[model samples]
Target chain A: MAGLTKQEGLSSPVSVSGLSYAYPAARGGNSRLALNHLSFDVSAGEMFGVLGPNGGGKSTLFKILATLLRPGSGRVRLFGQDTQAARGTRKRMGVVFQNPSLDLRLTCEENLLYQGRLYGLSGRDLARRVDDALGLYRLEDRRRDWAGSLSGGLRRRLELAKGLIHDPDLLLLDEPTVGLDPGARKELWDHLGRIRGSRKITILLTTHLMDEAERCDRLMLLHEGRLTAEGTPEVLKGEIGGDVITLETEQPDTLLAGVRERFQAEAARLGEHVRIERKQGHSFIPQLVEAFPGLIRSVHLSKPTLEDVFIHHTGRGFWNEGAQQESRGT
Target chain B: MRAIAALWSRELLRFFRDRARVVGALAPPVVFWFLIGSGLGNAFKMPGAAAGVDFLQYFFSGTLVLIVLFTSVFATISIIEDRREGFLQAVLVAPITRLSIVLGKVLGAATVGLIQGSFFLVLTPLSGIDLPLQGFLWAATAMALASLGLTGLGFCIAWKMDSTQGFHAVMNLFLIPMWMLSGALFPHSTAPGWLRFVMSANPVSYAVSALQHSFGMGSVALASLPLCLLVLTGFSVATLGACVWLARDQD
Candidate 1:
């Protein structure tokens, strides 16, 4: 453990500087940029999240860090060593891909054993590590069972166990809870928290779920291959400095103009909803209702959330925009 | 070395666990041997000097080569599956070198090919091919080398493909023809001038010639025993080298 900290003298666990990546043109389509001059640093033993929607370049970032894809430009350093030049860096990190990497036909124990050997673990040490992983993931009873036969949650646990078998100091997971149910997702988070507490490992995960992002110690919000915001959930939400108010109206543009002209408040129309971010939102609701008595169909006000922070920075509803982009096949 | 051993064992574990894959690889060649060998018996004759040598006996050696080919191709197809399902990504990121990954997979696939090819050896007596003690050893050695070469070739192809459909296309267009022209269907001496040229150049021809010489069933020698072994070894090394090169990066 002390030797592991030797590289931790004066550097963050993970750092990216001026990183950019572009996907090559496929067939007749033009090449698309996946990441753009992104830079961030993750402290040792911190749980960090890259929060984004589909095609937001989080996956590309994950690949570059995992050393699966070379960065198109710039550099990524893990534990003060450039990832491109450091083969030893790979030995110190555990990566869990978005898709399940388990060999479905093999038993839980066999999968871990094989993974352990990939890191040069063997003899009694490998056996003990495999046993410990099975026990820690609560997979002892199912050690002999085929991985494909396990329930979805158990299989995910086995994946985590395999990733941890070599006892990597840094763990990277890409969309770890994509297909998991709420209960399983929570359980997975709980396990992650426990692992961090016990081992002091640096855990970096990417997720599109706002609730999942809220659980991170720190998060960077990505949109269209750019970082929109970076901070703890509280700090990010706090940047709004007030409540978020939404007014449902049939004529959103008209109400938006009226609110801007009459009250001189900054308001934007998003679909059928006119949104305003302001301080003292509760008191403003009455003034808003009085100004437009028959026009305002409904009014909703709430404290700032991660989504509100996203909308404040990007000026678009997260889910709706994501859905629209997906439908258009962008 | 340890990584190679681990990956090799993993391949064996997965192959044995999937009963369907094991049966699928072994059963086809046996069926083809009995049906094609018996159906085309004595009706077929060679252009060279050997007479009264039944096609069943001649095709028995071909069936052995087919077993090796089918088993190797089917075994290496798992590489495509592993890539699509994300297993290859895990291996690619591991601390092991690409050479170890290639060696492990090629050896694993070769072992499957060897086991299936050896299983076909038990039926050689039924085809009336007498195997002397020394000849059986030579034949087994030839079978193993052929298996390694074929499996390495399959690995090279599978590593580049993302879809099983693409692999199937390569199998039909490239692998099957390679086998057909390797003196598996007919002797090189009987082939036309153009086809004879192809048979002589095919690496698989050396493997088939080695097997025929070991079995003492054919007088036609496209290449000598030492030359055949050298070519087969070169074939294995070249294909394995190609796999290592292709697997050096993940794009």
Candidate 2:
């Protein structure tokens, strides 16, 4: 319900006010609002994350900020300038899309060089920058090799290098680690952290990964085309005020009734599991198991994650990869 | 302008790098020209009948038109896939204008078509059609003009299409007939009344006529060299204008 629109300076790296977007109707279906009255601001030199389930409007917001889609209502301002006339500000923002945008047939070096030239960077300066990008991403050895020949992890690193070869002030990433191994994802984050450390760059990346969201300086949770919650990960986790208890049971309805009657804690059924939130949730587990006899199958207790934060703000559980194969933004 | 040149160069780089695609696209025309020209040797009387010209000699210009069509048109087909999932989104978000992007891509494909045309031009002796230096230069110029116009036309068709299957469908529905009716297989005098009328409306017919004129067989075509040049230039400008218009979310 709380949204920031008319805050301070419009010159912030990214500022959205009353933003809403509706994809045009299918032949028989009515139009659906992909984003509804969303408002937020990402300050300079901050790593911000938008975490959401698929169809939660992460990509719609991304497209608007990246200047790919024109907003249906409200405004997206990049560095004090409206995105309508994004020509000047577009030079300041570099976007790494969810899709692999590299020309696989072109050499790693040529891909970077061509990206530089698109931004009107050329000659020896562009060449030197390409070299620096190669050295920075450790792609120097693969400079002459075809991009398609590189592994997914190496290709992603090369993609990051290409995105930064122009040295833009703001970097926008959409699901930056969509198809990478855990180690590769960690490597990418390290590189991103290194970029932020060495330069005055503001990064805004969207993801469904809870740990990835935790790495961000500040975060926003989106569900069903609305902003459910927004704050630092720590603060958002603190909103739940204690630990989260997830109990897997064959009959969640009966367990939910008994747990609430016996424990006097916030309890709800999430899919096939009973989730309870209370202070000292770990201690409640032994009592919960003792009361239930042979009813409880499994119990998981942990600090509230971004996923729990999403569930805390919205009763619906987060959609995993199996639940949402492709986002509605597509 | 530099951005446009970079995109243009990238297109050429990708085209040459795909060895299988390059060989696949360039080889068919040679076989078509050789098999058809030899199999149907100088049987039919020349439509204009100036002298002892064989079917191989008459079909040389037609073969040239085929090469230009196949190479350049196929080049623009890459756009549909790029627009759907890949490299083009990066180009769209870049600081460059949409017009420059269209010009860059169309001109790149046009250049590829020109190269293929010139490659075929080198083997004019195999067809036993001896062209002097003046004829060769004129033929090259005509090829360049045809390549530009057709590639622009291809860009126009492929720009808004999301699927290459749809593009191929459009190609089969429209482009193949345009090539067939351009007097590539048979001359104007040989066609029936309605067929000639349709061929008269086809712009590629003008390109074919221009190429025939460049081959020193101007009488084989209905139009003169200057008229063909004017038509080809007009077609190039019109199609390029359409592509730029489509590339723009708004004009």
Candidate 3:
């Protein structure tokens, strides 16, 4: 519910206030609200992540920030200028969309050249910038190759290179690591971190993957078109204020009831396991085993993660809800 | 202006890089011209044909117009493809004006159509039409104007469409009929009163008439030479305006 501050001379790199959007009705269906009074601020030189599951309004927010969609209400400002009102704001910002935007028929260098020209860069300056980007992304060797011929990882790198060819102050990436494998994802994160370190540019990226969200300097959790939580990953995880304990048992329901009754702790049944959050969960694990000697089969004790923070705040598992909604074809 | 030039160059780069697209845009019209011209030449006769003039020779200017139509259509369809593939979104978010985007794309497509149409014009000798140097230059100018107008029209239609299937539907239902009634398929002199009226009303009729006059081919012109030129220029300006208007906002 806390909106970004509009204090004079205290402008953040990106700020949003009372942002909302709705998709118009399709056929017989009524209009659906995608974002509901969302607000947040991303500081300069910070890597901010908007974390959410599918249909959680991450893409809608991304579209609005990238200047592709007009918010139904409220305002978005980049560097103290209204995003919707100023064409100059777009010149200072770069956007990498969720979908591939590179023309596959053109070479890597050609794509960068065209992207540079869109931002009004041309001549030797444009050529030098294109070369710098190609080298920065380690795509110099593949500069002449068609974009379609590159692998997914290389194509993503090329996309990043093109996005930065104009030397933007703020770069918006919507799920930049969507289709990459684990190795490629890590490599991309490393490159992004390097870019932020060397260039001092602000980055805002959206991702549904909890691991990806953990890499961000600050994280905002969005669920069903509302801001659920916002903080550093560690701070958000610490919101639960205890360790998470999971116990595998023959009868999870009975074991959950027993734990709640005996330990006076809130325990929930999840599939074949009963999970509990409490202080000193490692010591409580042995006690739990002793209390349910024959019922418990296995136990797990670990620090809370971003996933746990999400569940603690929303009362549901992130992927499970998303998968169910997806299966229902919503 | 720089954005327009960049976008225009990008279109040409993509067009030339895809050899298949370049070949695809040029081949079908030539084959259509040959088959249809020869077939119709044997069966149909001109009502007031001069000695040594055949249907193949008479159909030559029409075939050039068909080439311009095909090339322009192929060039403009890339707009829909770019939108589907996300390239257009990237361009839309840039600092450039919407009019520049439309101008760049329309000019790019028009240039492609003009190039292909000129390539087809080289076959005038094959059709037994003797085009003098001055006439050839005029024919090229008329071809460029016609290409610009047709490509602008294609840009208008393609800007509103989301799918190539919808574009194909429009092409069949609207563009082909426009061409057929432009006296491209048959001379306006042989048509009935109502058909002649329709031909005179079609903008493309002036372009075809201008092209026919440039080639020194005897034909029934719906309007005088200066009048045809004026109409072609007006058509180009009007279609370009419509395209720019349609591209003003992202939906």
Candidate 4:
């Protein structure tokens, strides 16, 4: 973390240089790489996002960073300490896994108390922290209720409280908003925003949601076990250098060929729509429709988004390959 | 120490809160003991014993061991859920050693098994066996040793498992067979030579022998009480070591 992510005098909370991981084969056959020579650094107090499609190595990266899996190669540093030999570093990382980690049988207060004890937090200090956590998450009223009895949002809030009970410097969440309604997702993000507002704690979360990715201060794109692009959402979208135009036409292949020939513009078919990137997308839309007449169904124009940047770099729609955002449990 | 204690107490607290678990761990053993012991009651007679020691009295020691065996192993089965996706995963990332995990979980199950097995002891008078307070104390000690060893063994198997269905298969095919061969349902003396050799080698057989001594019963093929204890302790330590090893990061 020291040199990889440091700029001037800032300490990187997480820095991975040339990270890779592959699950062992069940039988004697070739195993697929879950992470491939990945390198990145998360600046302190930043809400760093790892945006990727499912099976694009997000969960594997999360596990390696959380010290559940050993790195296949290269180093992962937390506050400039190697995670392989990371007993002390584990104290600094608060990880909320995609899976529910709550003891459903235990009450909310008991869950928090025991989680505090695991981090060696005990006595009056632990009790106060548990109290503070319950209060902060608006779970004070449900303190005596079983975790299983809480609604999905409340259970997630309790999970967040449990993860932060020891007050870690870096909080890692893997697909934190999974299986949540939109209201709950927004509420969870609001709570996270509140947490970040309270202190300059580094937060790194993995998500496939573009809107959620926009909330991050900065993020990287991952596909097929490799880094595709990395930057702030605005900057990544700015990299496309123009507006994006989508043509809904019956003859997408013919339209793509004719657009390339007549306008000499680069166009690619993205599923049901033919996608084109032009400096003046709105003006070009008129010429496109007039030239094609009835062949073109409709034209839509918008500013370049993170998905366009992804398509620009990866030469395929973000959902063209794996549309499902399901995590593979390793 | 605090972490392990918290984890251990959580298991006890969960068990107490769930009345079904308390009843589930206990009821089967009693039903098995009563049905089997009575069905074979008048058909059995010992070669050398106090007068009128029926099959119920003779089978009491093995039945006690069986209670601990089932209770301990069944409790440890939850370790699969913990490893796959649950609270244990959270604790696994904490600044704690693998030994803490093994000790916390194994001892929790062992303690629960001992408590539940003690409830079965109240029915010993039905066996017509003379068990004084000293005898009960000795029996409890033997039960604790049995629980600790068997629970450690359960932890070892469960640490590497990914699903409860696979664990249930192991419980049926491996653990249940282990108890059966430990002279639980039959006498080691009347067994065939090959079966006798297998019973002599089984660690639970030594546990049953220790319990027989605790209950002042006789086994023709009984190992010495001190030797039985030594074996149980060695088995517990070996299993505990294997469990910690399996729980490590690299493995």
Candidate 5:
């Protein structure tokens, strides 16, 4: 099957700078900005991950790239063509939305055929392309099955295949694997990894999973519509510059006050534990042990994680949603 | 042409797939053709009306027009489903021209409308209404054009509406009243003056009137000819234009 020629490589990195957006909401008849000067660049052929809490504008940014929602004020270029223009920009990109887009009534093969024909392919050419996509996604066996009848993982894989059916240069995925079992999620990730190796399809995926974010070549941490940090996973962890000292104590508040007073250390609480950032965890342990001897039942020293990196950068967990104070109380 | 064929084929495939949908598309025209035609055929008072003609003969056009109207309006459900399922987005992102996309689906749905409208043509003889070969051809042409017009209107409405409930409500508010006022099931002379004006302005009324004329019924309303033809032509252009405009920004 003939796909887009490699000689037609991506032009340059997608760039967005000084972009601001706001949704009009009636609150005493007032509107608020959802995003403020959100600027970030995605280099071509790189797996770029955007990590953020729920309602933190991650999906909003994805929508902007997908061209589903217009940014109130911003410049968005796809392969250097203005997205708002619609004609030249669409040929370069493929988008798989968060909502399921597959036609459940049609068989998987038929759905792909219909989508391919929309892009001006037909007869033998269309059939060959469909076969290629089906084989690539490992869905050749179940190509005759209805899309709605497939498991969530299979459906998601099909969605990816459908999006790529036109052989687009860029793939924009909005929470593609939002709800899948662990085994299925792992399997889907493997398929994703395989595709990335085979094709230079530039992928920009929005994910809330810390582990998934760590797998990306580069990660952008977005907090409340703002870019807090951008770098490789290791570099992001290195930015924190210290080991994490976690204190598991029954009386965390009392122990925290005493530790602050004696050791002059600040800590962030997570459930029943308090994670403190310190240069030397081993050296600080004895001092902490002596001061809060009985209260500090156990002390664990761990390397900084992507979750920790996000927390350090955004001062919040990746799963945290600001509106639910009661949820955070847990 | 290929895009239109693909879209139209998809609609036909979808229409035949659901048993209930097919039955729903055919039921109204068939039932109304018999009931209203029989009632009016017995009580009609037009002195110079064709002899041996049952009310079903005069009502056949209206019933067929109803089929076109119902099929066109309900086909909007496909749009809602496509939007909900994300299938529409897949089509929108393709490299084909946007007008082909709208034209394809509209023509596809209209094919079903034409088929259902033609079904009533078969029952016309059974309803005691004479069906000549020329009558069938003319009526078929009228139904096809009316279905095309209605499908175009449906496509335009579906483009702007995102929710199924809203789509249904608009269909009910816009189409149901227009169908009732169009002299489809009843004679326009019996309707109130305001309704007569509405029927005069209604494109469906002209469509049904044109179909009725094809069946060798009463004199053609000359004043309505230009008005109906203009609305049909103008709305098709305007709605299609709107569809193309909306299609461009489809991310």
Candidate 6:
């Protein structure tokens, strides 16, 4: 139908500029600046990832794009229409929140059908679409089961299916893989990849996982409520100044001192391993071995991964530091 | 329209699946009608109508009003649960007007009120008192309008709210005063002059008066049918406006 046509790659998707937001002070404290002049564009049919640590403004940006939260200043346009001014922009978007949004009381099929009807599909149309969604998520077998009884991964899958039941032009998913096990996470990625391939839905999602960000067609990194960097995975890695080399050693400080004296290079020591970024690590290893014999136990040479690029840009490990802080604070 | 239907289905499905909640939703009005209806049954008599109108009939009308009020207020819990569970975000993200959501929920909660209201209708006949089909229909319509008004009110209050406890507290704070002044348990004539003036201004009093009119008591002094329906329409509109305001983009 005509609705199916809009489900194809958006001729023009969402674009924004200079979006800024501040949350009012909770109780008596100072107001928090949640987003600081954030600016980015999601092109048609691209799987765009927002990578950020907790409280890094990833969700705040997602909410702004979803029109759930209005930006205090700046403009957000969906399909070339100002989201705040246009009353109907919302109809073309679908979102899967960080938490499972399924109504636990209803069956999977019932939930989708209800969502479909909410979008104005009913009768035979609703039934067919709901069935398709259930099948798409491989949830047909459990159509009659209560949503609350489903496993975490299954519920997440159901959430995805429901978001797409309306065949929205844009899909905004926030931290969709946060709680899933590795197997389930992979399965969901497969589903997501298939969705982009087949339906051409413009997907904008947030995930702190570097591997997940690498899967996206393009990515934007948010830190302290600002966009730090954005580019394709390949482009981003290429943009990093040099290759990353890690050497495991019994005496990292001794090995690092020798390397620093020999090449005047910066060496970061972490526990028993030392990381050095250089133009050619494999060629330097031989000279290093000769300079400081037997100091190194194992050496690995690889091009910069997204994590390396993140470290090069941010000066700190992304997920590790955030994870440590989260654990410690709790 | 499709959005409204979806929300309505979700609400009914939620109501049916939560057996304890459904039972809880149904229990209050029944108990109130039985206990309070019995005590106040003989306390009311429509002027010029023979003192012959059964006390249960008079109080049953009030019970129906109470059912509308309680069903609408308790439906706020579903909204809070949906938000906490992340379902509200899913709906808001959908490409549908927010008004459809409020309408769907109001209609769905009204369905519950109708069911409970019908229970009262059924009980009257069991007690050997039969209202005409017209009377039953009129009462159902009145109760439904009241339910819609309250559902809209409940949606406005529950929208974007974080906690169920906080919502329940607000619901009680708003609902109790409205119920108390609604003349649901007592006739306005027995209230103090100032209280009567307050009851006249209270929307629920208009609603209860309309409901009592359905019992064939002919005491329409509180609110005429046109006035009651006009206020009902205004209540729905104002509540919907509030919902829209509450749902406005807040990045």
**DockQ values for all predictions?**
0.77, 0.63, 0.75, 0.75, 0.57, 0.56
TM-score of chain B of 1: 0.96
The models' CA-based lDDT, in order, is: 0.86, 0.86, 0.85, 0.85, 0.76, 0.77
Q: Looking at model 1, what is the TM-score of chain A?
A: 0.94
lDDT (10s digit) by residue, model 6, range A1-330: 234436863335778789888988999799999889888888777789998888889888888888787778998889788777544767678888887878887888877877777676778877888888888899989999998889999999998898888788789889989999999999999998888878767898999888999899999888888888899999999886577788889886777677777877656665566777777777887776787777789888889998877766665566654221210000
State residue B35's C-alpha deviation in candidate 3, in Å: 2.6
Error of 1 at A283 (Å): 1.3
Segments in model 5 whose C-alpha atoms lie over 4 Å from true places: A1-10, A27-29, A249-257, A269-273, A321-330, B1-4, B43-53, B128-134, B220-231, B242-251
In candidate 5 chain B, where is summed lDDT lowest over 10 consecutive residues? B218-227
TM-score of each: 0.95, 0.92, 0.92, 0.94, 0.90, 0.85
**Between candidates 1 and 5, the TM-score winner:** 1
Candidate 6 chain A weakest ten by summed lDDT: A321-330
Residue-by-residue lDDT tens digits, candidate 1, B123-158: 777778898887889889898999999999999889
Per-residue C-alpha lDDT of model 1 across residues A1-330, encoded as one tens digit per residue: 344456556467799989999999999999999999999988888899999878789999999999888989888998889887657888999999989999987888888988999999999999999888888888899999988899989989989988888888899999999899998898898899889878878999999999999999999999888999999999999998588899999887778888888877757667788888888999999999999988999999999999888877777777764221111000
Put down candidate 2 lDDT per residue, A60-146, tens digits, no spaces.
899888888998899889998888898888899898989999988889999999999999998999999999999999998999999
The clash number for model 3 is 0
By the lDDT metric, which is better: model 1 or model 6? 1
Q: Candidates sorted by TM-score, descending order?
A: 1, 4, 2, 3, 5, 6
**lDDT string, candidate 3, B13-84, tens digits:** 778877888888889878888899899888877775323457777677788888898888779999999999
Once fitted onto the true fold, the runs of candidate 1 whose alpha carbons sit more than 4 angstroms away are: A1-10, A321-330
User: Residue-wise lDDT of candidate 6 within B120-215, one digit each (tens)?
Assistant: 667767545567888777777777778877877887777767788888788678888888778676677767899999998888887778766666
- Return the lDDT, model 3, position A129: 92
Candidate 6, residue B93: CA error in Å? 1.7
Choose 4 or 5, whichever is better by lDDT.
Answer: 4
Quote the positional error of residue A190 for candidate 1 in Å.
1.0
In angstroms, how far off is B9's CA in candidate 5? 2.4
